[model samples]
Target chain A: MALAKVYVNYKQSILNPEAEAVHKALKRLGYGDIEDVKLGKYFELTIADGKSKAEMDKEINQVCDKLLANYNMENYHYELVETEAAQ
Target chain B: MALAKVYVNYKQSILNPEAEAVHKALKRLGYGDIEDVKLGKYFELTIADGKSKAEMDKEINQVCDKLLANYNMENYHYELVETEAAQ
Candidate 1:
């Protein structure tokens, strides 16, 4: 099997109020050295191993564009890792 | 500076309905080969560079336990990467 670790985050130009709140909270909690904080989404996908790497890449990209990411505001990237097949 | 990428996910024993719904959605969308789907939270934290690795590690652990994760149901991990100092 293969595992895809996908991350989806807002574009740099976008404002993230939740992350801003967390940053402020951290400062209030005495973590003054923290310069910035960004909150995002993560997904783990397990796929049966059969397709070639190129094919897998294509499918993953399609899935991200179609479901996992909002093209107008968010961007996504993923890393693929090989794993032992489950019995 | 240092960039910390933190990932928080539900523990295996916990049921994640959102993730299950996503898996079903993918299957319906023709990604039948996708065996499983898990969703979680991701955080990117930028910290001023000064502390030793051990200090950074300890601080990150404390932050995760105190803010980034729910110890009862979620597990958290992080990767710290050195980044160029801000101009």
Candidate 2:
């Protein structure tokens, strides 16, 4: 099987309210040394066997573009790892 | 400076409705080969200098326990990478 570990985050130019809230809370909680915090999404996708590496890569990109990420506000990057499937 | 790249995910035994919804959507969208999907949170923490690695590690754990994750439903893991701060 192939596993796609995806990380999706907002564009740096975009304002992220969630991250701001967390940063404020962290400072209030005495973690002032936390210079900055950016929050994002992580996805683990397990792909079925039988596909070649190139095919899986293309599919993963498609999935990220179509569902896993909002291209206008967010950007996504993924690491594709091959793993053995249990019989 | 140090960057903490944190990944938080639900325990395997727990059910994730969001992931399930995405899986269903993917299948409907003709990505039937997607065997499974797990959703999680990603956090990028930029830490200020002046702290030792051990101190930073402890602080990060505390932060995770108190803010970044819910032990009841999720778990977190992180990679600490050293980086040069912009002067």
Highest lDDT: give the candidate number: 2
Per-candidate TM-scores read 0.96, 0.96
User: Model 1 over residues B1-87: C-alpha lDDT tens digits?
Assistant: 998889999999999999998899999999999999999999999989889888889888988898889999999999999988752
RMSD of each: 1.5, 1.6
Compose the digit string of candidate 2's lDDT tens values, residues A1-87.
Answer: 888899999998999999999999999999998999999999999999999999999999998999999999999999998888721
Across residues B6-85, which tens digit of lDDT does each residue of candidate 2 receive? 99999989999999999999999999999899999999999999999999999999999999999999999999999987
DockQ of each: 0.91, 0.94
Taken over the whole model, the C-alpha lDDT of each candidate is: 0.92, 0.93
Q: Kindly provide the TM-score of model 1 when superposed on the true structure, using C-alpha atoms.
A: 0.96
What candidate 2 gets wrong by more than 4 Å, as runs, is: none
Error of 1 at B65 (Å): 0.7
* Candidate 1, pairs of clashing residues: none
Question: What TM-score against the true chain A does chain A of each candidate get?
Answer: 0.95, 0.95
